[model samples]
Target: MDELDLKYALEAILFASGESVALQALARAIEKTPSETRELLRELMEDYDRGMRGLRIMQMENRYQMLTRNEYFPYIRNIVKATPASSLSQAALETLSIVAYRQPVTRADIEYIRGVQSSSSLDLLVDRGFVRIAGKLDAPGRPVTYETTPEFLKLMDITSISEMPKFEEFSGGIQLRLEEQPEENGQQ
Candidate 1:
């Protein structure tokens, strides 16, 4: 391979190695044959050793990982900024549950089910990356539809929505009809 081609291949491998670099993904990214990429990587690893760089390429569990030479982690962490994480409220949790169960539902539908306006709660869900606007529904008037994101699955620790708790069987106390209340015709 030429110098430019090899440089691009090396850069792609390094960037992908930040996470695990699978051979197929690296091949697709580099648009080259997997065998050639593997050879290039071996050469790069050898060059890295001969240059005395503080980084190394490693193969583990059928994936490649590019990491600092272990002696440099403390220096790296000290230079990075740290921020405190925030917690979600009970209201947000309930709203999230409703969205998770009834998506791709609209914001109005969520409000109707919760018996309250949910603009703020919808904003919170979107901000936290759990819910996303799937697209507008194709009904009489188009209303934005929302669905739980893959991030939601990750946060909830589930591989799929089928694993969610069954809410269909829970009957009654949830549906309080307005008309069922006793008539208040000036009765004490």
Candidate 2:
């Protein structure tokens, strides 16, 4: 097909899927090389941006998705009557952070890092589709391992976990203080 036809084909595929399409899959669909297809996709993205269209194409790693621009969320929400998703609690957010950085981690590891049980927080993250069971570790009891999902990446507005800020960048500013407790025996 010609250039315009190829662009339309890519656009249609992205719109119909309503999800991220892999670069290889898109290339196969358009019968073009991966590099050529990537170039075409970039041009289409630019066209949308230049036209000030309500829709935008986002590239997440090797995949591409067509989505309504964030600026138009109010209008889309009004038409869809969508309810606002509940925000994650501090505990859940902490659990999610652990899973994101040390993925394929187990509940035991998460609890150890947080210094508390993380069952509820982990469950909440699983329910929200931000985290998933990757598999089980081959240790003694074969504990289940957890990993962050693509939905988590989308929520974070990041294409890859590598984009996350380095731990050292923020760790330097945080300080932890523990209070001493009185002994129950009352033996001065």
Candidate 3:
């Protein structure tokens, strides 16, 4: 709406994009010409620089992105970097099995399948660098879906997820036993 509003909006958009956005595309999104958008970006860059902010905007070739400053990388790395988990607990293993097999599945679905709350197990899988939040479902509430990361593939010594044993192998045995039960409700 106003120039101040536009500036704030651009800041939020750049942060959310998490990747470079072309100047032309950003202008179109904000209903401004390329030149106008470029000027606004410069002003924003200067503002961040003047304040010595830990996060700054960078122009990567023809696009722009907001990222943590190089000076702070050491701290960020200290916080973010970690050794991958060497051993998985039983719950974590179970959670990983579900994610690997029913990939892009949600926390709710995982809990339902396992018949218990599994927040901690899921947390361990994520912190251990095995599973990741793939994306959100389009349905209401936008539940986060999960999938195995490349690290998991490499650790499991597999080239692709499809190479894993069939999901039916994990589920079919249960179904068979249930179906094998004799009918008694109507007395045959």
Candidate 4:
């Protein structure tokens, strides 16, 4: 299909689907190679961003979805059909932060660092779509490992995890003893 045709097809599919559309599915629908489809979709996404639209496309892993721009979230929330979501608890936020930084980590690993039973907090993060099971570790338990999703990056207002503030800098204040924390907590 031509570029304009492909763009319209994508727009129609995304808006009508009301969900993330897989890259492979989009490629098949457009009768294009996956790479070409990706490029076109990326261009489309950029166009939406640059066009001053109230909506934009978000790529999550290998799928894309149409999403309202962050600037419109408050207004959207004001008109939503359900009760507003409660804010994340401190423990949930802590667990999410740990997973975002020490990604592919296990519940055991998180509990070890946090010194608490983090099952509920971890579950809350996963249920909220901020965290997901990445893979199993090559350890004794072969534990299910966890990682932050693209949604997490989007909510954090960063394109990549590298843009997040150093985890050590944020947590070192508590990680170290008073004497060590003052001089050598996160300087490195």
Question: If the candidates were sorted by their lDDT against the true structure, best first, what order would they fall in?
Answer: 2, 4, 3, 1
TM-score to native of every candidate shown: 0.50, 0.81, 0.47, 0.77
103-154 per-residue lDDT for model 1 (tens digits): 7788888888789888898899899888899899898689998878756765
Task: Give me the displacement of residue 112 in model 4, in angstroms.
Answer: 1.8
* Candidate 3 overall lDDT versus native: 0.78
Ranking by TM-score: 2, 4, 1, 3
RMSD after Cα superposition, model 3: 14.5
Tens digit per residue, CA lDDT, model 2, 57-109:
88876888998888888988988987778899999999998888778889999
lDDT of 2 at 137: 100
Off by over 4 Å in 4: 77-84, 157-188
Q: For model 4, where is the 10-residue window of minimal lDDT?
A: 179-188
Q: Who is ahead in TM-score, 1 or 2?
A: 2
RMSD of each: 13.3, 9.0, 14.5, 4.8
In candidate 3, which residue pairs clash? none
User: Each model's C-alpha lDDT?
Assistant: 0.68, 0.85, 0.78, 0.80
Off by over 4 Å in 2: 174-188
> Alpha-carbon error at 73 in model 4, in Å?
3.2
Superposed by TM-score, candidate 4 places the C-alpha of residue 168 at a distance from the truth, in angstroms, of 6.1
